[model samples]
Structure formats: C-alpha cells, structure tokens
Target chain A: MKVYNISFQIDPDLEFQWLEWMKNNFIPSLMSTKSFTENKFYQIKVNADQSPTYTLQLYCDNIELWQAYQELQANDHLKELQYTWGEKCYYFCTEMQIVN
Target chain B: MKVYNISFQIDPDLEFQWLEWMKNNFIPSLMSTKSFTENKFYQIKVNADQSPTYTLQLYCDNIELWQAYQELQANDHLKELQYTWGEKCYYFCTEMQIVN
Candidate 1:
C-alpha cells in the first residue's frame, strides 16, 4: 500500500480555521475522488515551529492511483490552499510504503 | 486515540539488519506490554539522507498508557537499540493525536 502524507505547520491563531477547512473541504474533497481508500488527520504533539503541526494521511492501493490524484485533483486543490492560507499554513508532502 | 511514532534513518548497508531487529525484537517485545492496541511500520519513500527512512507507529487509547510504556519498557528498548546500532541507525520520536 502507498500512504501519502501532508505535514503542515500552522500559526496558532489559524488552527481552528485551517482545521475546519481540512475536515470540511480538503479531506472530503480528496476522498470523494475515490483515489484513496482511507484518510486520517493527526496533530503532532510538538511545537517545534512554535505553531501547531499536523500530518494528514491518505492511503491508496498503489503509486498509479496516487499519481493520477496529483495530476488531476491535488494540484489545483493544493494551489488553492496555498493561495488562501498563504504562510499562515504551510506544508510538505511525503509518500510512504507499508513494508512490515 | 494517541499514536506514538519513531522515525528512523538507517544507513543503507544496515537496512536489512535493522529491519530484522525491529521486527523480531523491538516491536514484538513492546507490543507484549499490552500498552498499545495496534502497530504499523512504514518506509518513507524518500532518500533524503541517501538512506532508508521509516516510521514505526504504535496506537493506544490515551497518554497514561503511553507514559507507563515509556517508564517500564521504552526506555530500556530504546537504550538497547542505541547500544546495538549506534550511529548506523538513528531515530527521533513524535506523539500525535487523532483530531478528526
């Protein structure tokens, strides 16, 4: 299985807004595409950036499905997030494989 | 629920050995404590340090059990790991809360 992760760091003041957007819009919109079978939102219990940190996880069957997601949907959605949130919420993406 | 993660970076030459020790020794021993309800191992698909990176996750219901684990088991296991692998394998810890 392939797991796609978006590790985000958000200003403390924007946590509530960013979280609502993630739950109501970001996650739901991505899951609706059927490219991913499961998704979860996690708040990292650290303040390394002096802000709230989180990692949104998306699980899919293979890289092909993930690539399709990036090409067709994720690009625009991510772009919009950047434009809307600006530096208040920034993130980096990662993909992982379940090896054991 | 709470998720405890150990993100490890291992020298490529030590990958196989480290994987074996983690699977056969560390993970099983820790799970025997009944502190966590579930566990998963993920290999991050990035050669960020020219080596393999992995995240080992253990899920529990709350922080109390996790703390108990840290007190009774994790300290010893972690120390053992450091003693055994030294610089060949290094890791950092993170705890997370499932917010949605």
Candidate 2:
C-alpha cells in the first residue's frame, strides 16, 4: 500500500476546531471518495513552536489511486481548509510506498 | 502508542545494501531490544533528487520506552551506520503520538 502523509502546523487557538473538522467532516468526505482504504491521525511529540503539529495518513492500494485523489479531489479539500482556517494552519505532504 | 519515524536520504548506488542491512541487521537488533512493538519501512513516492528517500517507523507503547531505546542503543547503531556508509546515508527523526 501507498500512504499519503500530510503534516500540518496549526495555531493553538484553532486546535480543537481543526481536530473536530478533521474527525467529523473532512475524514468522512475523504472516506466517501473510496480512494483511501485506511486513515490515521497523529500529533507530533516534539514541536518548537507554540502551535501544534499533526499528521494525517491516508493509505491507498497504489500510486494511481493516490494520484487520482490528488488530481481530482485534493484541491477542493485544500481550498475548504484554506478558506476556513486561512493562516491558522499550514501543511506539507509526502507519499510513501510500504516496503516491509 | 507512539511512533518514532526516521526518514533517510541515501545514495541510490547504496540503496540495496542499505535495505539489506536494515532488514538483516538493524531491524533485527532493534526488535531484539524488546523496546519496540513493531516497525515498518517505506520509500517516499516523490523525489526531485537522484537519491532515494526512505522512512523507518518504530512503534512502542509509550514515550519512556522510546526514550530508553534512544538513550541506551540509538547512538551505537547510528555510529555503526555512519561508519559503514558515512556520507552516503543521512537521516532525520520525528516522534508522533497516535491520535486516531
């Protein structure tokens, strides 16, 4: 499986909203897309900033599916996040192929 | 549970040796320590450079166990890797707490 990992740095004031939106709305919509087989969320143990860092991992069967999600659905979700949170949150993404 | 994620950028020429060493020696020794419950390896899907980027994630029950592993055995293994590969391999690490 291939994992699409998105790590975010979020303003402390918006942490609860971010978590709620991810758990209730974002993830559910992502699941509805049927591209991801599994998903996980994580909080980074070390962060220098006052803000919090989080990671969201979405696992898919192959690169093609992940690519499809990126091309077709990523922008909308990204836009939604940007519109809602603006500068309160920012993120970077990485994709990994499981070898073990 | 907690995940200790190590990401590496290794010279492509030494990729096979790195993988073999990780599978044969490093991971085995890590598991033998009884500090980690599980581990996984992955190759990042996107790269602008010629080198291959990989991630190794070790899971443990808590921060204390991970700290124990880090304080007790990490440097020795790190030294062995550096001694063997030198500048050909370099890495960064992050720790994350499972939130969902």
How accurate locally, in lDDT, is each candidate? Answer: 0.89, 0.86
Restricting to chain A, the TM-score for each candidate equals 0.90, 0.89
Model 1 Cα displacement at A98 (Å)? 0.2
Residue-wise lDDT of candidate 1 within B1-100, one digit each (tens)?
A: 9998999999899899899999999888878899999998999987556689999989999678888998878878789889999999989999899996
Q: Least accurate stretch of 10 residues (summed lDDT) in model 2 chain A?
A: A44-53
Q: A1-100 in candidate 2: lDDT tens per residue? A: 8888888889888899889998999778887888999988999876565579999988898678778889999889878878888899998888888896
Error of 2 at A72 (Å): 1.6
Report the C-alpha displacement of residue A78, candidate 1, in angstroms. Answer: 1.3
Please, what are the lDDT tens digits per residue for candidate 2 over residues B12-38?
A: 898999899989998798789888999
**Top-scoring candidate (TM-score):** 1
Rate residue B17 of model 2 by lDDT.
90
* Candidate 2: segments with Cα more than 4 A from true spot: A62-64, B62-64
Q: List the residue pairs that clash in candidate 2.
A: none
Q: What are the interface RMSDs of all the models? A: 0.5, 0.9
